[model samples]
Target: MGGNFLQSRSAIRHEVGQYIIRNIFASSGLSLYILVDTVFIAAAGGTFGLAALNISLPVFNFFNSLGLLFGIGGSTIYSINKLKDPKKVETLFGKLLLFCILLGCGFAILLNLFPTQILTILGAEGQTMAVALGYFRIIALGAPLFMCNYVCVNFIRNDGNPQLTMIATLSATLVVVFLDWLLIFVFNLHMLGAAIATLFSPLTSLTVLTFHRKNKQRQLKLKFAFPEPKTLLKAASLGIPSFLTEMSTGVSIFVFNWVLLKLSGNYAVAAYGVIANIAIVVLALSNGIALGVQPIASREYGKRNWENVKTAMKLGIQVAFGLACLLYFILVVFKTPIVSVFNHDHSAKLAQIAVNGLPLYFLSVFFASQNLVIMLSLAAIERAKMAFVLSLLRGYFILIAAVLIFAKFFGVNGVWLSVPFTEACVCALGFYFLTSALKNKN
Candidate 1:
């Protein structure tokens, strides 16, 4: 499979590119379901319910970061090494699967031990605390399923059966939505129903992905193997950028929640929640494009095919920019309608805050997404150091500085502008490193 993609001509390359993108696009159905989930929560539980869910997002992201760290990191290495040694591919997959389960369990234990403390830290209080804790406890129990499902899906995709991956994702989306309606609307379980719906959805993904084992072209194996410290470290180093890229969301959201709570109380947080959910769709599109090209680029580089590497990166950037423009226009033109969808009770103040913030906030996706693609490109080629720097700068350091400085000066509007400013800075640095890394190849 590696040789086939690596050796394919323009026609096949285009097909491969489209195939990868379609699979990734389908995989993002989780975000779509999240959008619907938010709508349901807002309709049933109101602004405070929405706020509670948003507050709990950081914890969910923390566990998700752990999954990406192992899933992507190990898959990157697996893509490159599988062309040279098949046996080692199985070993690496085994190690990543094991690590994912351990990390998930560790997170579950932490949640069980510190549920109240974590809820307080997330800015929950009284009614919101009750709602958020209900959701968190149920989600915590599914940590292992979430983490392992993420790892398996990534492995399945890179194993040469992206169709199966796409099918798995779609299955999960259907199951989640159906259950959400049944449990939340029919049964009136409210937050508990929402959490249960989200939790069980991943099991469908895990179940569907198991079909990949029957594929003759599939190479990812789950044969049990003793873990090696060095291999674990290697995968972690490659995957750290993904972890930080994801974890950055949690960290920034945590900061934003605190700042918004300080500035305008629960209503403000609720407004931001609406915007954040919209941002997820945009981010997922960009991620699909970037991740779509990763295996291709990584494989070509492993075989020392520089021209193919350049082609993949160029295609990814073009698609990201195109998608970004489309998303921005949609947000600007339909700002009011979009806000109203999640605003539920039609609070004028909440609508005003979110509507005013959406334009500037959505613009950030343009540069921020391109930067993410470049960061992933660097990581794919084994330029881990440059990738790490880019992730750290955008995901944490620059993000923190931009949000604080902008909020202090621009007030609420500044808070909205911080994301683009941070991305612009990182996008510039991303190009610099991309140029340097590509130049070194010459």
Candidate 2:
């Protein structure tokens, strides 16, 4: 090529690098803090406490996922649009903000009103039922804040303010960790304290959000607008797949929890909780790595820069494998100490069982990483249907099948083993879809 070609390539690479740092730093930091905080809470609370927290986590994550749908789906679209039509970006942001707020309130009311019913469906029996209800009720109080914070942070990243997003998340997490210690340990409120601390996290995040938006948001004003039925419809259409992908996990977790509780007892529930809890920590980091790849892929796809998209996928997979390896080592090496951090001897065998199964659980990180790339990359390119298809394969179809078949035959070990098998299957399918899309595009 020529100097012009070389300069353009250099610019693309620079943008990709910035995108990577911002995506990984902001997402990973938020996930790590939350994961660590969960582990610490489990440790402080004991078997029942941890089980209750674990039981309730899927519900909380589901709500958070709603935020992900509008915020992330909107942000990606918004970013691509700004690259071309900067003036029209506000329409996108305005609609999403409005829709998310309404949905947030709706979800809050539904969850609060149906806490007992929801917990019962999710396998709450005795104390597990009580603790789940307590935790759920408190967190339900902050639903509005939770939804708003999602829009704010994702928008910051969309606006190319990763540093601000990182700082904002870190501040909220740091505050939650401190408050968690004081409320759960010093005051001994158990699940109630955990719930309050959970509420405080989003509140702190919202504070940072307000500060960030007040200063930097010139493109999109956040005033309350009457519900735009079309905006909510569009968001739901574009975002539903992502929303379902996460919602499926909540369903899966309930199944997983119920199965474990059935196969063993409270100890088993607590043990599996340890594994699930740690998995969240790793999954969050993996998500960070994958999300870092998203903007690069999205921006490149916008300009039809397919090679960078492919390379970024490769890089994200490598990062995911590297992270999984690190996590595997910790599980194998420090399994006892880490498990101890969550529970004592009551869960010793369960912890060992978890350690035995840790590597298997992460074996598909490479594939999982690729699947994530294809999903978001497609969505970023406005291929929402394709994204939904892949999401369904991984989240619902493959995972559900794997869990049932494996768990039926192998028991709890089967439950753990299902992760990789399903991930590999869905990833292969995702690859097929991505290749077809590329062929059609080219």
| Predictions in order: lDDT | 0.83, 0.71
- TM-score versus the correct structure, for each prediction: 0.96, 0.91
The ten-residue window of minimal lDDT in model 1 covers 4-13
Among all candidates shown, the one with the greatest TM-score: 1
lDDT of 2 by residue, 246-325 (tens): 66667667778878788887777777777776766566666666566666677777778776666666666666667667
Candidate achieving the largest lDDT:
1
List where candidate 2 sits over 4 angstroms from the true fold: 2-7, 213-218, 305-311
Across 287-376, the per-residue lDDT of candidate 1 in tens digits comes to 777778888888888889887888788788887888788889999999999999998888888898999999988779889779878988
> Candidate 1, 142: how far from true, in Å?
1.5
- For model 1, the stretches where C-alpha displacement exceeds 4 angstroms are 1-9, 12-16
Error of 2 at 222 (Å): 2.6
TM-score of predicted structure 2: 0.91
